[model samples]
Target: MLAVLQVILLVLDIVWWLVIVSAILSWLFAFNVVNARNPVVDSIGNFLYRATEPLYRPIRRVLPDLGGIDLSPLVVLLLIFFIQQVIVLYLIPAVYRAGV
Candidate 1:
């Protein structure tokens, strides 16, 4: 059970990084800093979009348009952080107590 919790924590950490990278890549694409015409760049962008878009779609619907700015990523990051904290501070301790 502890091992399973650890695996979940690790996966959450990895996804946190993915969110950051995806946001940066989106910004670069938006600002024309990266050329999406290149196959490599396009592929990476598509991958990030596919990974993140589903999560963002619901948040986007809830949030009113801010003229082109997107806040879903920030909201998602906050949610991920909150979940991580809950698992670390509450769930893991509960599991440890249960084992004893």
Candidate 2:
């Protein structure tokens, strides 16, 4: 059970980094800093989009438009942070106390 919680933490960490990278890559693409025409870049962009889009879709539906600024990534990151904090601060300690 402890191992499972640890694995969940690891997965959350990976997702947090994925969201950060996706946001940075998107900014790069938007500013023309990276060539979207490059096959490698395109592939990476597509993979990131596919990985993160499902997470973003629900958040996007609830948020009002901000005039071309997307806040879904930020919202998702915050949620990930909150979940991590809960696991680390509350759930882990509770598990430790329960010895399971």
Candidate 3:
């Protein structure tokens, strides 16, 4: 059970990084800092979009339009942090201390 919790935590950490990368990549593409037409760039952008958009889509719906700014990734990162804190600070200790 503890091992499973640790694996979940690791995945969350990875996804948090993914969200950050996706947001930054979008900004780069928008600002023309990177060539959107490049095969490498397009492939990476597509991968990130596919991975993160499912999670971001619902958050985007709940959030109001902010013109060009997107806050969904930040919100998702915060939620991930909160979940990590809950598992590490509460769930893991409780389970271990309880001899489970």
Q: Which candidate is the best by TM-score?
A: 2
> Model 3, 17: alpha-carbon shift in Å?
0.6
Q: Count clashing residue pairs in model 2.
A: 0
lDDT of 3 by residue, 1-100 (tens): 7988999999999999999999999989889999999999999999999999999999999999999888999999999999999999999999899887
Residue 55, model 2, lDDT: 100
State, as a TM-score between 0 and 1, how close model 1 is to the true structure: 0.94
Candidate 2 overall lDDT versus native: 0.97
Candidate maximizing lDDT: 2
The list of candidate 1 runs beyond 4 A from truth reads: none
> Which scores greater on TM-score, model 1 or model 3?
3
Better of 1 and 2 by TM-score: 2
Residue ranges of candidate 3 with Cα displaced over 4 Å:
none
Q: Give the residue spans of candidate 2 off by over 4 A.
A: none
Worst 10 residues of 1 by lDDT: 11-20
Residue-wise C-alpha lDDT for candidate 2, range 4-92, written one tens digit per residue: 88999999999999999999999999999999999999999999999999999999999998988999999999999999999999999
lDDT of 1 by residue, 1-100 (tens): 9898899989888888888999999999889999999999999989988988988999999999999888999999999899899999999999999993
